[model samples]
Target: MKADGEALVFYENGERVGTVPLAPLSRVFMRGDVTVSSSLLGKLGERGIGVVVLSGRKAVPTMLLGRPHNDAARRVAQYRLSLDPDFCLRFSRAIVEAKLRAQAAFLGERRESEPRSRYLLTLSLKRLSSSITAVDQQATIASLRGVEGAGAAAYFEGFADLLPERLHFCGRNRRPPRDPVNAVLSLGYTLLHAETVLALYGSGPTPSSASIMRSTSHANRWPVTWSSHCGWRSTSMH
Candidate 1:
């Protein structure tokens, strides 16, 4: 299936939803005739799981929506900024340049080593632990940019080759597949990280136990596409 399946769906009994996912899940698509109870729907929405419903032959949608996240408004604001005439012109170019430079750095480090792509995870972990000293690049642009988005974008843009673009903050939709910019925004990675953090945060039993439960529940409730969506597929979706 294509990576971004539109919305998380609920079926009459979620039978179609039960097909085991391929791996590295991303979005949940609900079909078949089923009604999500208020409580269940609310829980799904709170997870910020995008929902897409199909209509009968009548050509009317049964339901379609996105759950409002606490940070949704803030996210929306960032999108507006990304499209700003000045920002798009300046930042987009800046991002492209930064990404190129980062890829160069990553490659240079392994000039005599293995392929640049294979060493990405090692390079990423190294950078993640690298210390950051105080510095100013574009004080004005930094001030205008959203803190989270800016930091995320700058680092990933710079290290485009090393990180998976799935982790980039594309907002609304899944990051474009194989997009140099968004390779870091892979939803699968974020989901694992969140589960781990939640487990630790609970201060309950072993984090792994909670982690396992939550991850499984998450998969069942809103299975990210088990298969990585590389775009374009056959009718069989294999």
Candidate 2:
């Protein structure tokens, strides 16, 4: 692929294939073996367009983030906020609460649509509500994570009820998803995570500064965090 003025020109077997306007594009996803020029990468970075490359069957992703907001002071402040324990705790509580609420709403909708799953959904909803309430009571990040994990466990129970029996989905499992439902959910969550990082980079905050209720991966060490509240509503709903 090559950048031609304001567009990306595609080629195949030494023949021109198609053209896509770079202006309308926010991010680019390239699978295994796809290649592009360094000049195009620079152009994309200049336009705040992130490029994510996925390689191999596992689809391990490597991201070339766009140029972030130029406000150095803003980034500094964000870094400071990330380090503040009180702020992180408060922010994490809010994030977990929003995630649980979204889960509850999704389960409630499932209950309405699938009468046969109402019992399971109702139980999950109640569990989520309790977790939401407990979010305020948590003092440390570890405890908050526990609350979130329990809520997610309950939420997945309801999610399992919505899937077809053929999928044989009991609960959330990943890193080698044993079932179809888990596989799709894992893929959706991975995409959501990429989008979240892009959004954060676009807004000038370092995605690594996203230290609230998230861990640093040993592989790339790109401090990854997902907008799980939005994920439950946008991803799980579909």
User: What RMSD does each model have against the real structure?
Assistant: 15.7, 2.2
lDDT of each: 0.35, 0.78
On lDDT, the candidate that comes out on top is: 2
lDDT of 2: 0.78
- Separate clash counts for every candidate: 21, 0
Decoy 2 TM-score against native:
0.91
Model 1 worst lDDT run, 10 consecutive residues: 229-238
List TM-score per model, in order.
0.27, 0.91
lDDT of 1: 0.35
Model 1, stretches more than 4 Å misplaced? 1-42, 50-66, 70-84, 115-238
Candidate 2: where are CA atoms >4 Å away?
Answer: 214-220, 227-237
Q: After superposition, how far is residue 24 of candidate 1 from its true place, in Å?
A: 16
